[model samples]
Target: MLRIILLAVALCLGPIAGAAQQTVDQPSSTIAVEDSAERDAAIAVRIRNILAELEGYEDVTVAVTSGIVTLRGTTVDQALAERLTGLVARVENVVAIENEVRQTTDVVEQLDPAVERFLDRFRQFVTYLPLALVALTAFVLVVSLGFVIARMKRPWDRLAPNPFIADLYRQVVRLAFVIAGLVVALDILNASALLSTILGAAGIVGLAIGFAVRDTVENFIASIMLSIRQPFRPNDTVEIEGDIGKVIRLTSRATILLSFDGNHIRIPNATVFKSRIVNYSRNDERRFVVDLGVAYDTDLVEAQALALETVRNLPFVLKAPAPSVWIEALGDSAVTLRVAAWIAQRETSHPAARGEAYRLCLAAMNAAGIEMPGPTYTIIGAPASAPQQAASPAPAPRQPAKAPQNQDLEAQDVGVQAEDELDEMISQERQEQADHDLLSSAAPEE
Candidate 1:
């Protein structure tokens, strides 16, 4: 057991000794090591002085070797270390900077292209900032004077009372001033050539993209046209492409409609602009024609008068248009008449008003002793009582011709069968004469 323990001890020590030897003999790959020592010392001293210059502040430390500077310390914020690194790098001989500094408190670092671009733009503004600022202020003052001049050019009576239009005009003037200020600032920065080059490149790229998305471009243009032309404004009820709804909003590519059932429908602006649109609320006057049928036996004069009265009494119906009634046609069972009335505003439910008018007219007719014809069946035929029979006295019974077996010398011995035969022959002759008379009556009048 002792030998076994000794062997185990030897095994562990052997690997440790070999590893230590290998580590001791490892060669360094750095060049100029001996020559760099003095330079490194100088760099360290310089970094120490620079750090000493900032030491009064809390939670920060700095380290340096050769031309490489390393920040090592706990800071209340990591951004302080980053900002210090940037300031030190601008010094005479900062070959490299490594931020080993850690924040004592939690801090969020956000790196975004838009943010970086904004910072770069801010730096540019700082370099030529004061000139740009002064130019912008002057431009605003000049644009305000331009608005004053524009207002003066127009008559006071012609000036719009709309606040929105006034605000829009102000915004336009401000935007123009800003654009001019930007051009002037670019000139001050000696960046006019760069700006032009970027603009030209952007125009070419934009043209290519526009061709690639021509349909989309067309829709965008159509949206612009719709906005400018004001074909339909928000909340206007319109029928486009057979779909009826109120305009909710107009987007770059489509128009949104709020359907009566409260659905949001998006239709392409191109389709809306190209299709026929019937704006129901555009006109203040709308006409409604009510058609009704009365029994032919009814008094037409009374019905016409009652219909006109029904329309005249409705408050929504316009009087100047003058409600008119026309007997349209004589139908199979009734006389059809149309009553037309114009209302001032079409936005009102005209169909409902028309229905109410019909009900009122029906009631008025009933009160005026005029009857609406219900479905009726009329049968024309002979009277229910006994039909008129031909006026003729009964024919006398003829003497019978005897059967051969019953033959007798006297003819008064005739039985019933002989009388029946004679009667049938007379009936057949009467039927033939009746048929001939009927055909003669049916012939042409000439």
Candidate 2:
């Protein structure tokens, strides 16, 4: 009876155990499916949030299933659609993407935001109109005041002797006032932020312009320096960089020269400032040098004495500095002598004095029987012959020319007149209307 009861109980317990196992396994599988669904929903929400944050993706929609993401809706273009897909692909737990986004070319939709922005700006400008007008009025008044102050001449006159520099000073003062006025106007209008931006841009542009026009700026600066230093005056004969001429005018850009050949030369002021200048008119007296070659057999001492005597007798030559002659070099066939004499450049013509001295010296030497020799040459392959010796020539008769009693230097009137004409021209150019106005105004009635 006990065995029979045990068999029946075992059958009932076995079925109950199997049913419990099936129930546990079913719950475990359902929990996993629910967890995966939650994870996919979370990923889809994150993708939507990310796409919304990006520009031009406001209308984009995102969906996710089991680790796969889907991007759908309209964007501006295909590029934006691809960009959305790319962004979604980077999210965690996303394995792939299905992009169904399309581009819409609706003109009204595109232009609506732009029109709204412009209208908003227009409204703001309308609100600020009165303030802008006031600022403009202040600027004009301040600029006018600057102009009036610049027209005053006394300060610039005291700054420099050159009229050009005085004008520059006036302009500088005016520009300073104008800048200050602009700053004040900008401050009044509460436009300091705009001013700062404009000034920054202007600074960059100014740097570029400065690099492009560096040479022009240098020349202009050199002109200012030359004007202040007064290196050469009008009608002064100057040789600058081997260009010999008389200075006709000193303009802002270049130094105008009237060449001896009647040609006009315009040298950049920068070049003139840096070059070596030989001014012939600075000193009243100038020395002239003559190179004389005498035969090797001639007496150098007697030849020098004769040359000195001839130069000294000339009326145009200066007696105080006197004349000098020296043996310069001894060549194969002749001896070279340097004869130098000082002449009053303002009182005598330079070329005329030199020519007269040369003529007199040659005549005196010829009459004195001094032989001026030429270069002697011999052939290399010539028949060898006995050298013939000639008889020594007798000394020529000493017939000295009578010297003038008056030793006073005579003035050359033509040079003085030419210099005066140049002075008059420069004076005319320098006569400023500002100076005239200052002088002509009848004391302003006190």
Per-candidate local distance difference test: 0.62, 0.74
Error of 2 at 446 (Å): 40
Residue 411 lDDT in candidate 1: 13
Estimated TM-score per prediction?
0.39, 0.66
Q: Report lDDT (Cα) of residue 381, candidate 1.
A: 51
TM-score of 1: 0.39
Model 1 lDDT per residue over 128-212, tens place: 7787677667656666665664455244313432222333455566666555655665676566777677668879999999999
Q: How far does residue 297 in candidate 1 sit from its true spot (Å)?
A: 4.6
Candidate 2 C-alpha RMSD relative to the actual structure: 12.9
Residues 1-446, model 2: lDDT tens digits: 99999999999999999868655412222223333878899998888777767777877777877776777787766787767655665677666567788886788767766888899999999999999888889888888898898888887776656667777888988888787778878999877777778779989999999899999999989888777777776667899998987777777788877776667788998999899989999888899988888888888899999999877877677887989999999987789988999977776666666766766777677767788766766546435585755757866654434334343333223234544555455456446422321111111111
Q: Clashing residue pairs, candidate 2?
A: none
Lowest summed lDDT window (length 10), candidate 1? 437-446
